[model samples]
Target: MLDFFRQFISFIPPALVPLALLAIALLLVAPLGLFAFNFLAIKTLFEELRKIFQDIFKLIIPKKWDSAKTLIWLSVFSWAMSLPTRSFVQSFIAFCGWLLLIPGIHWLMHEEKKIKEFLTIEKILIAPWITGALICFFLFATPESLPGIMVISWPIVSAIIAALPKFIKSGPAYKVPDPPVRQDLIIMVLFNLLLSCWIQLCYSTQVWLAQYPSFQADDLTNSSFVVKTPSNESAVSQGFDILRQAETALKDSLQGQSWSQVERWLLNFDDRIRDLNEQIIDRLPPKAENAYWQVEGRVLPGEYNVQLFAVWKGPSSDNLGYHLAKTCQISQGVPVDRTPWQTLSPVGSASPNTQVDTATVSCEPVTKRIKGQPDMAQ
Candidate 1:
């Protein structure tokens, strides 16, 4: 009875798995949204939200409940929510520092008369800077560099721009006059243009980073074979062992060859690897089909790196009516190096929208090494 049920499930399309999971999630979460809409009546919710917004507005701008203060706070909140948590915290600290520092600087410079004007300008300029910084941070910065770059660069640039006018006016030029409002508007526009250019550079760097594939040594050391049944474990291991032998043979044959010669010999090397993979599959208890393997070789001055991929289909366990395909790859002919495995087609199905289930073990190389040791030569 169990076998019959498994057979029925094996016939289901692989694409349906994601749809089923999504359906389950919606089924679980729909009631919560409905509950908020039903038990908490829409009219009551809106009234409560309005009160909450009023309270927050009063807290941020305690003395003045004007449209300008409301707009400033709204911009701050919008910018804060767009950032990742760490960046958001740093931005908040910078914001508080800006609020305190601007007044202190004005007081020390005996420019208290212009403090209100400075506050108004700062609030107006800050919104656009925050918006531009966040846009660059998200679209340009890689996951590793996002927080540090955003935290360090953004606040410093903002402080410089805010203090620039005071610095110029304080200079001992024969009673330097306050620039016209037109000049202030021009400065703001120019600063925004400069920020836009900086963002363009960051985006260009990100594009360059995306062009090349990363190679890591750990990806090779930690590679594993995918086996759907316990009985197939030995077969998978044997296949890997055969692959290692073939890799060694290819390396020995191609050693000391120039790049041109290696390129010429690649076709022959691939044929040999394919033959060995077939032999490995033939030895397995379950009949293997749609079997294929690829060998990639790169020759350096003193050493060469080789990566291998082998994929084949075998009889599924009785529970699944369709065949099960096992696909795995290993890196050999070098001490430590790995290339990411590329899937040519969905492992077992051979064609799109097929019922066969694929079991894939993808290898990702980790490049870190111990202290005092040289990094793995990629």
Candidate 2:
């Protein structure tokens, strides 16, 4: 069969052949699938299957099998089939499994209703099951698994389903309004739109939180939404790790350098930090922007103080934003009385002179909640 399909498609252009094959495949499957669904949906077959299952387990299955039970069973089976497999065949089978529910629901809705009496309570009873089945199918087939068009279609489909009940006529003689301009449907649609906006807002907020995790440290008390805020320690953990790594790099690079070399390196602190940022910035989340690390050095009486700050400009309680701080003190292993140049003999001389002392570095605990925004220029 595979060889025949390949030979049959060999006549078409390479670019169009895949599409042609897909069209052919669909054409072949559609009729068979329709027939299978119609056969399974026959009232006698459905009842017989239900009766066999219930009779075999009558002791454990006390309730009579109904539409709800059937829908629930189908949902569970579909989920189970999709959960453990990633193969194309298994995924297709799972897709077919959920589609079975559509025919089942359609059969139930038309089982006891006349064409004009669809607006009756009995017909309306199946609406929730349909809505639920759609929701479950979407949840089972996530955005990543589905095509872009399918993902975009879900919200519109959901809105249409929500408004379907409004079209249900209350009685046989009651006519739908001319032009169909009903206030209830208009309000329902507007509410659906508002609900969509709220959902989008929540998703955007989650993206912000992920990119700028430091925002989780903010005092959300004044905010209207009651969200579960992460602990201060957890929120700043990434910032602290960045600072600590930079401190270690600085110590390793300047460990054995002369005092003058140390001073010169600190003088180009901004350049060194920029290069270091380029090295480690890829570790951050893709959407993280305007977030970086800065290091500054101060020459004390006998020691060098280097303060590392992980600064990020993002949504926070204060619009100014926040930074995490870590201070490290670098000192000479032994007190140096002379410079590296002086410690060496004259250029022409062969005499060995006193050894030049190197700097030793140690950092303190990382601090959180330091106010003020970082200077982007520096």
Candidate 3:
């Protein structure tokens, strides 16, 4: 397919460069794939969508049972193309397995119905494994899997085409046909391929949506500090060792003064985070997708959201002890002994959707839930 594109781009007259470029961009990056070339058409809307999806999913999930041969071919082709690397063998095997896996599933189930009328794990395993082994040893032993996969899909595609009328006879929800292979099986394949490409587009768009706002929060970057000490090292170097080193000096300077130890530590910590943020510049969101930070609530109507400023202030500054002593704005601050403000997410910080507005994590608790590490807080 990529080869075809490479050839296609070379054939266009120089005057038609813009049109060709447009087509290429749409083919590779549009929300829907190169829609025109696919030539997929369906009379029924719902069935069309179903068949289309089954086809589309092949990109992410192979359609092995759709054709054992195609699966093997695909595996071998992929293996070969991935030269300058040797791991393609495993991938080829897996692709072939998946190609046969699902269809093999349905086939064994159909066979079981003819006999026991019910399925057992053993009954399901035999034929698919046998088919997969045969495909690997006989066909995919070479690197023709790319076109091989296309060829392999034909018989399965043909079978699907033949069975189409029967599948729909049962009606929409009752038993929609698996593959929507038509006389133009190539068209169907292309259609599904386009849909898969659309999915990739949406995935990329989603990531952009999530990341753009953070990037825009350039001014907010200063909200987290990156202090460079006279030592020419980040204040954050060696896990707050810099803070600890400054602690004794601070304590000496505060001789007979009444500031609390934890408060002093937090002050220095806050300064550090602030300095980090100062080091980074701020940016605005791109017009393509307007970005903002938002949080969610788990209550009945989960739409309850809290939008935070792009540039954020750390929770440690808003820690119960500090907020109580200095701000006095949040009168009923969280209890000191209770859980700290943290996120349950992988990063251990809350998104705007979370209930916990601020986070405090403790690594030394006896009954810690996160193994030896502290739970993340927001």
Clashing pairs in 2: none
Q: Where's the lowest-lDDT run of ten residues in candidate 3?
A: 321-330
Per-candidate Cα lDDT values, in order, are: 0.44, 0.64, 0.37
Residue pairs in clash, model 1: 6-319, 219-365
**Residue by residue across 1-378, what tens digits does model 2's lDDT show?**
999977877878899987987998999999999998898789778899999888877533325466534664675678687878888967786767767666555545544345226635653343543554465464555755653333334455566776664566766345464455577567656765676666667767767778666566666678887465444434443566677777778788788778778888877877887776665555655556435443433333446887667765555677776777777787777744555566567777644554567777888988866767654444
Put down candidate 1 lDDT per residue, 1-378, tens digits, no spaces. 999966766777788867866887999999988997887697798899999999987555725444344444555664565465566676675455445433433332332235344445634534334433554454347746664455435644554455455435444543433578547755755665576566666565445324311111112223343213344222232234334544445445555444445555554655665565565545544412223222222222322234443321222222221211222232222222122343245657444322322121232232122122121254
Q: Report how far residue 326 has shifted in candidate 1, in Å.
A: 32
lDDT of 1 at 114: 50
For candidate 1, which ten residues in a row score worst on lDDT? Answer: 212-221
Model 2 stretches astray by more than 4 angstroms: 1-100, 106-126, 135-159, 168-183, 229-233, 282-287, 290-302, 335-353, 374-378
Q: After superposition, how far is residue 108 of candidate 1 from its true place, in Å?
A: 22
lDDT value, candidate 1, whole model: 0.44
Q: Give the winner by lDDT.
A: 2
Off by over 4 Å in 1: 1-191, 213-249, 252-378
lDDT of 3 by residue, 135-219 (tens): 4444434564343443333334434443454446433534544465343445644654565455555566446536442222122
Say which candidate scores most in TM-score.
2
